[model samples]
Target: MIPIQLTFHGAAGTVTGSCYRLDIGDRHVLVDCGMFQGDKTIKQLNYQPWPFDPRRIAAVLVTHAHIDHSGLLPKLVKAGYAGPIYATPGTSDLLQFMLPDSGSIQEMEVERLNRRNQRRGGGIVQPIYTEQDAQDCLRLLAARDFGSWFDVTGGLRARFWNAGHILGAASIELEVETGGARPLRLLFSGDIGPEHKALQQEAMAPSDLDIVVMESTYGGRPRPKLDDSQRRAVLAEEVTAALAAGGNLVIPAFAVERTQELLADLTRLIADGTIKRVPIFVDSPLATRITSVFAKYLHQENGIKAGAARPFDGGNLRFTRTVQESMQIEQVTGGAIIIAASGMCEAGRIRHHLKNNLWRSNATILLIGYQAPGTLGALLEKGERVVRIQGDEVAVRAHIRKLEIYSGHADHDELLDWLTNRLPIHGSLMLTHGEPDAIGALHASIALWRERAPQVIVPKLDETYSLAKAQPRLMKMTQQSRRLDRYAETEAISGHDWHNDYARLMLQVQHQLRTAKSDLDRRRLLKKMQRILGRGAGTD
Candidate 1:
């Protein structure tokens, strides 16, 4: 009998690029081929070739339609994977709009880079996947309803359970039959949702598992159990504060769930007269389409109950899809709410809004979702007084408010409860989809489950585990050995980065010296270099 095996392709020690593989005998199955986001290191990881042959993979199971979980499917299809990609109906619907949008964004980014490369006489660049590639990949998708058992190749049975993280999100349950080896079961928690989401259901409980894979995105901290009323109250106050200041309330939102949720909250607030009726502009085209989908398919639509007023029916809401409509938003001097994406202010219409509103003393920039490190949103969240936007430094006079209560992922305590609520978890627990500190913190929390001393495994990127040979045992690594491994990697990366930065600074100094037309200009450049050198030395 062949032994079943598992491999981690991505999201091993990071919050994005979630991919996993299960090998059975001669065939393989995959779950989630997503794009990586965040700092340069994370984005660079996407440039690496796929670890395995895409053609060899028999099937793919998508938990949801978030870019970090499903963005790379078109690339997989382009790489010759002719297998069925399974997803829930809602996820499928979202992907139809989302994937092509991703392709378009890639094309735009590549065009921008090529223009720069052209000036430098560099090679031409191409997008990862074209819109046509995404359209081709859509033909391979098969929508499966939640709770339906589906069969994969190589005699494996898989089931999808609602994750409640977003519309059509699901947790995957796989039943593996390896030569009648007692038919083992495995559960993959595909980004578990927090409780009491405005438009989402709670994540289903996990049960009857031999081995379980979990996400630890929020493991390092816990979110307070803020209910609907509490969230509404806070949102009203934030909006009121923005309104009183007599400037726009700018919200950088994820086009999917976050946009829908915010619209629902706004509708309720307006209905109850908690805040003045303000014109709310939905600025992202993708978000506008997604909102329409929710209105059509979900019926009740984003916590706006059956009898409640619709998000756009109040006549104060506007959908800006064209450049003309988007630019017109700048003309609004005060008391308007502008919602746009890319959520982290990394790209798209949000940057324009930030450039306009961030300088206003009365403007309130409300961050309602997670902002990855090195993103413009993170810089603002960290209280950077001035930031560069579209080649200009803009003063950040706007008040910034982060309402993490709007986050959809399960937090530390909620993860614990989600685990404890399930029965027959007599198997090893492996944590992924988080940074080392978060994974480590979550691993330590397992000690409280004294009834069974759980064997916790935090697998590194691309690590493999054999299910046939040994149980998922505790990794008893020596502290010295681990320290060396960690430090060796850090030292090498830091050394390379230091050299590059030093070279860039030297080039800047050389250019300024060469361009100096007068003694005053030379002295100014000298003073700037001194300040730069002093700042660099302070870090050292």
Candidate 2:
């Protein structure tokens, strides 16, 4: 029997990039080609060479349209992966706008970085992939319906189950043929959704699997189970409080599901007199385009009738589609609600909105999604008094509030219930896409299952396992084949990196200088720091 090995290229120790490689004999395929988010070191992995040859991969199966799960498709194509990229129709439609937008973001960010580097006498760096590359990759997307088995390669077949996380999110099931009496059945739980998720039905999947690759995004975090109405009520309270504060409410939202869900709830809140009607601006052009995609499929799923009232439409809703329109939003100082994308506040117009509103004492910044560590959202959520935005220091005086009920991932208990429902596994259960604490907590919880639980494995970044019928065994790799050094990977996944430290250091230095009793004292401090830096300049 040929050995089947599974390798996790990303999202092993951290919950950002989510690529997985499946090797069935000589042929290999990818489960996802997501981009790395969070810390700068982790994001640099996007620029690193693929550990495996992309040209050899027979096909790619995409789980969803979120950038963290599907953002690197263009980079993969640019690197010579010409095989068909399989996705659901909804995922395909959403990615038509998302990938290009991601490419554009990359281009714009790199352009700005290059200007800074040029000023500092550093080398220029190109974007990982351009918008044209994203457009070119779109030609390879092949849309497939849910619940239907399709041929992936010579000896492999795959199917998609509704994940209930986002519009086109799915948990993929794969059947790999070996020489045994039956094929190896494996399921990949792609970002399972919580119960009563907005605009999504309950997540569904088939049972009695051999192996399951599941995400542990919210492993140790358990939230109150709120239905649609209850969830809306929670949001209504935040909106009312923000408006009552006499300043604009700025929400950093994901352009895909989170933004649409917020709009739906906000629209309802205004119509029912739960909250006063305010001019709500969807300030992301990508979000404006994605909202239309949701409109197309909103009634199709979630049991909403095709002729029913539009949940995302309202009299006061405005979508800012142009740069001019987005800039015009800066003129509104109060009594308006602004929603922008790049949920973690890593990039996009959200930074601009934050820069404008974060310093206002009356403004409220509502964070409705997960804030990955080291991102601007996480910094704000952590109560950082000052933050650097687009090279400028900004004091954080605005109200930073978080709504945990809106997260799409299933919480700890919910994840356990989801896993327990897929009981009687014949082989190992591997957990990925979580940090050390969350994964460790979930692992400890699974230990209570005693003999009933399958062998649980928490694989690390770039780790490979041999999936034999008896049991899965870890495989050793040559040093040359690993994408990142073990220590480097560990540091990258540790959340905050040197860039975060540098930002904090700069802020501290400025604060100390401003608070110094005299200019002479500040000069002495500066000289001391300069002397220390000079002494260590060439040591490393």
Query: Which numbered prediction scores highest in lDDT against the true structure?
Result: 2
Lowest summed lDDT across 10 adjacent residues in model 2 is found at 299-308
Model 1, position 514: C-alpha lDDT score: 73
Tens digit of per-residue lDDT, candidate 1, span 1-540: 676778877777777889998888878899898987765555655666677899999999998899989989999999999999999888998899999989988888889888988999998977889888999999998998878788977679888888879888889988888666577788889999998788776888458677888898888689878888888888999999988998999999999989888888888888889999989999999999988777765553222222244654567889889999999999997999999998888888899999999999989999986776556887789897777675566889999999888897898888887877654566677888877777878888877667764577888666677876336632344443231245433432222234334444565666678788988999998987789878999942
lDDT against the true structure, per candidate, is 0.81, 0.91
The CA-based lDDT of model 2 is what?
Answer: 0.91
What lDDT score is found at residue 466 in candidate 2?
A: 95
Q: List residue ranges in candidate 1 displaced over 4 A.
A: 299-312, 473-540
Candidate 1, residue 32: CA error in Å?
0.4
Clashing pairs for model 2 are none
Candidate 2 residue-wise lDDT at 495: 87
